[model samples]
Target: MSEKKPSLLEGFKAFLMRGNVIDLAVAVVIGAAFTNIVNAVVKGVINPLVGAFGTKNLDSYSSCLKAPCEVGPDGEMQGIQIMWGSVLGATLQFLITAAVVYFLMVLPMARYLARREAQRKAKEGVQETLEVTELEVLKEIRDALVAQRAGGNAGPEGSPAPGDRG
Candidate 1:
């Protein structure tokens, strides 16, 4: 008999239908949405807080690297200027995202998986005990049958018990 191979489309469909793939897609979508929320919080809350110390806009903070760091009439820079405030803002955003994802999503998921694993192990232990008990009962039954057969003998093959009339 010849076995049929799946088509490319069928293979792709099967891949997409897998649980991990669907879960990953959902996670990506949720992460994108969560990023928007994080960005809004940083802009609305963090920026204002930092504004108390400096400017509300992080990009406005910079340091001149070379001399004559002047802007042209068309609003172009003439020298190298390092915008460290923007880097600091980006770093803060990343830290906030990482902290929230770890504490809320990753930590809880790890705890839940650990609990599920413990429950599975407990169930397997009970099943193993039941299997052992069943095997022992079967052995006892087999031994009892053997004893009964040995104690009561008909004779050799094609023969009857002593009390039977043939």
Candidate 2:
């Protein structure tokens, strides 16, 4: 009998359902939403602060390659312009987003996971110690019983051995 191959749709569904894929999708959606907030902060707070040096409107800060740039009646321009201000704004937005995600999400999650792992290891260490102690106790009891049998004093109320002291 030939083994049936999974359909393409089934494979795609499985890939989508995988934990990493789902997490990435969620992250993308969250990042997209976070981008808006970050943009607002950069535009509102940062640009104004930088405006102390120059102007608040960064988009207008550009160098026209062709001098005498044509201007319309409605305060519009037409010329080859290098918009470095917009680039600066975009760059700042990216840096802020990365920093926020690292501190707010990645750093906290890593710390929490580390703490959880430490607690689990501590519990396991305690359990291991208990197991070792139990084994040692059992061995002692067996040795005591053997000694009593050899001495022909294996009664219910036999004298306690040195190792058998409570």
lDDT of 2 by residue, 1-166 (tens): 9999999999999998899998999989988999889989998898998898899977767888976676868888877778889988888888998999899999999999999999999999999999999999999999987887687643556766445553
On a 0 to 100 scale, what is the lDDT of residue 25 in model 1? 95
- Give the number of the best model, judged by TM-score: 2
The alpha-carbon lDDT assigned to residue 44 of candidate 1 equals 93
Give the number of the best model, judged by lDDT.
1
Candidate 1 lDDT over residue span 1-166, tens digit each: 9899999999999999999999999999998999999999889988889999999988788999986688978899988998899998999899888998899999999999999999999999999999999999999999986775677666557577555576
**C-alpha lDDT of residue 74 in model 2:** 80
Residues forming the 10-long window of minimal summed lDDT in candidate 2: 153-162
State the local distance difference test value for candidate 1: 0.90
**For every model shown, what is its TM-score relative to the native structure?**
0.65, 0.72
